[model samples]
Structures are given as structure tokens and as C-alpha cells.
Target: MIESKLISKALFSDKSVKSVNNLKDYAGIEYIASMNQTHSDLVTFVKSSAVYDSDGIYTEEPKLGLVVKTADCMPILLSDKKRIGAIHSGWRGLKSNILEKAIKKFDVNELSISIGPHAQSCCYEVKEDVKKYFNDYTELRDGMFFLNMSKVLKDLSEKEGFQVEVSSICTICNSSYNSYRENKTTARQFGVIWK
Candidate 1:
């Protein structure tokens, strides 16, 4: 049994489909869309349920959902008056410039962003070699590297004129969400946004 309950528990009673029903029911939307997700910078502006080999997707169509699953990877939802996006960004995706790719499609003057739970710098330690891809976003402490992905993402989005809101919960620190770094499990927590 899943101890941590979601915002809409009734939609998740049958966990066989993860939380798709929760999103559909909570948002009152019908169509569900997603990507194959390769941890790359690929961002596609989609309109239907057609799956693509990308890490991010956005749409302006009503009653449609843009979904992505994550454990430790950051789930970013980009929104504006006319568009909505869901992104999957880990260190690799960030380094590949996924955020910029997703934001470029929308008008920043009307955009507002929400970053979902993920592994924060407080527990996300990395090797020194991986530090070369990021400079201002990472810190070297006690001969180890820690990444502030939320800040990096916030800074980047703000630079592009989007109002950003980051999640206070960390997947590694909060057992409510799944974390690969904590359990080496492929199980992921779903994050979705729709129009």
C-alpha cells in the first residue's frame, strides 16, 4: 500500500495505471499525452497523445495533459496564457539545455512556472568530473559536489521572464516521493500539467 497519499486519492485507488486517472479526474481533462523521455534536451510542442522521444512537451490545446515521470529528476511545468508544458530535467537534461528549449516556445510576458519535487543539493552529491558541465549551478563542499537544480532552473527561467515557483520538498529527504538516489528504484513519481 502507498503510504503517501496524493491530492486526489480516489483517482488513484487502482494503482495499476499510476496517477493518470488522478490527473484526468482532478483537472477534468480527458486526453493524456507524454514522451518517451531520454534525459535529453529535446522539447516538442505537441497537440495529441502521440509519444515522442524527448524529455519535454507543451501544448495550448484544452483538455489535454502534458506528463512526465521522475524520481530524482526535476519535473518542471511551464505555463502562460496560451501554452502549458511538462519537462523532465536532471543534471544531464539541464546541461543539455532542456529548460531553454521549452521556454523558447512560449511568451515570457505571460509565463508562470512550477518546479516539482526532486533531489535537492542537500542530498544530491556528485563526482568532481560531472561538475565541469555546470559552474554557477553547483557547489564544491568537503571535496564533493552538490547541485542546486531548483535555483539554477529558477535563475534560468527568471532570465527568460518567467515567474518561477520551486517545490520545497526534496525527493531524497521526503519519502512521500520516489528517489532513485535513495533506493536505486526505477519507480517514479508522476508530475503533469494541462490546459
Candidate 2:
């Protein structure tokens, strides 16, 4: 488990742990709320511990850890200390503006965003179908296209008047984390945050 010093009360779990339930003892936060991410723009508010059917989950409830499970997709955590959120941002989620919808739940001036291990542009090569949606953040090399999720998300969050700290670890190239694009792994890492 790795903690971000810039974003308090959060941890980005690597392949060492497969589920948020296993992270309870390690993170010291027993109750965690998670969601069945569908890569949509759906953002849900949490006041208790229960699995939701959305890509984003946020809460003002104390000690309720909000967790987002991901393999290669971006695991993002949002917090202002009193309130916190976890977002599962994939290409579909990004195209739907899930991050922006979650940001609206809090005052942007006090929010801090953390992006965990994901498929970076270096290894996130995409075909024209996917690349077209992210033209401004895509790069073409040797006639192939790559999508820079960090740059895309960072720019989007900054434009909303908040700072974003992204982990440089690329899941596709790093063995510490699981990557769906790497090996079609069913395993996932958890990005958890709480007040």
C-alpha cells in the first residue's frame, strides 16, 4: 500500500492486495464504501458502507472510506478533508466527464485530487477509434496513437481550479500493479480515501 503525502487519509494499493477488504487492517479504516464501476459518468453520494452501481462515489460521512477498484484504468481520489471521493476513470468515463461531475460535489478551491497507477501514454497505445476522442491529449508515434490520461485529467482538473497529483507508475509497464491491457488480468487495485 502506498500513501500520498500530498493527499491525506488515502492509499493506492498495488498488486500486493487484491481487494479493499484485505486493506482494512493495513489502512486502519474498517468500513469502506465501493462501487461497481461501469465506466459511466455516474457519481453517487455515500453516507454509509454499501456497494453502489456507479463509477464515482463521494461522502461527507466520517470514517467511511470511499474506494475505487481499477486494473489499468485511472483510480482517482478526491478530498477536502471533511469530504472524500473515489473515481474509476477509464476512456469511457473520461469521455462522459465523470471527474467533472464528481468535482461538482465539493468546493473546488479546497479540493485535492490524486490519480493512482494507470495505463500511461507510453504503453497505452490506442487505435483511431479511441484516439479520436482524446485528440488533444493523444500522441502519434510510428503511425500509432497513444493516450495520455494523466495529462488529460490533470488539465481538466486544473481547468476546474484545483490541483491534481498523479502517480507516474504505469500499470501496463509496472509489475507492482495489475493491468487489464497488459494481460487481461481480472485482479484490481483499490484507491481508498476517507475523512
Candidate 3:
């Protein structure tokens, strides 16, 4: 009962109210809740309208929509036409395999995935410790290490037996996209999917 869509910048105004309204506009889905987003491997399932009261945990009511906002972090979308999930995956989240964990919670063979715009390694410079977490097979250019998050997620989706499509847009490289690294004070964008 879940479907994925990459919202255009015009829909989200970098404001929570506007973003939430935009989501409502697209699918009549409301903001149930979101997490503090520590970039951990924690994956929560939202199933009720009440879950929106809290942001850090999962719900069980199988509601109509779910959302996650991001600046540089990866917004991982999951759905199978009956249930749906959205996760914020930064380097720390990626290192923890949050996407794998989330997908495992559902019967996702027929699920579809969409990796919303996020900070690419091209614009996401990290310290050595953070850099070391990714496999050495990751691409590098211009003295900065880069990971094709969409590719990684797409591969994972295929492995999980779900159909997948990825957007090549890079948040950091594209001026149209919102990026925490590019503008420290700018607002973030929402990556939303629901059934």
C-alpha cells in the first residue's frame, strides 16, 4: 500500500508547515511523526495516525502516509502497496545498514523504492573515520571520496526483490536542491512515500 515519489523543490518551502501541507496535497497523507534522526540503524514502522505524536519510534496502524526530511542525509523510501516507511540515512545511517533493516520488516518482493535527493560524496566531505566506513570500491574524484547512494540502495532493493528506480540528482551539486553542507542556514526538503 505504499508508493514513492521525489517531490519537486516547489512543493517544499524549507518550512515544516509548508512541507507538511505539500505532502497532504499530494496524497492527503498527514505527518504522523518523525525522528531526531541520529543517523543510526534504527528503522521504525508507522501504522497509525497517533504515531505522529512521537518522532523517534514506529507505529503499527498502517496509516496512509509517512515522511522524512533531509538536507544532506539520504531519505530511504520503502513500500509494498500495503505498508510504507521512510528513513533518514546519513553516512552513519548508511554504515549501519538501516535500509536493509527496514526492508526486512516487511514482505517487500513487490515493493518499490525511491532514493530522494541527498548529499552526494562529491559535496559530502568527511573525516577519515567516516570515510573508512564505506567499501573501498566507492568512487572518488577531485580529492573527495564519493559514494553513489542511489546505486547502493538500488542494488539493495534488487537483492530484496523489489522493483527500483533512482534519481541521479545530487543535492549538494544541484543548486535547485537543498543541502546543509551548501548552506548552513537553509531549510531542508522532505522525502515522502506512502500507500
TM-score to native of every candidate shown: 0.87, 0.96, 0.78
lDDT tens digits, residues 59-123, model 2? 98887888889999999998884678899998888888888899989888898999999999999
Stretches > 4 Å off in candidate 1: 1-17
Provide the lDDT at 193 for model 1: 73
Instruction: Tell me the TM-score of model 3.
Output: 0.78
Model 2, stretches more than 4 Å misplaced? none
Query: Which candidate should be chosen as best, given TM-score against the real structure?
Result: 2
Error of 1 at 108 (Å): 1.0
Alpha-carbon RMSD, each predicted model: 4.5, 1.0, 4.4
lDDT of candidate 1 vs native? 0.75
lDDT by residue (tens digit), candidate 3, 1-195: 123343221122233434655666766665445555666687655555443332223334444456677777777665554556677777777777777777776667656666766776556666567667766526667666666566667677667678765555677877766777877845777765544
TM-score of candidate 2 versus the correct structure, residues matched by position: 0.96
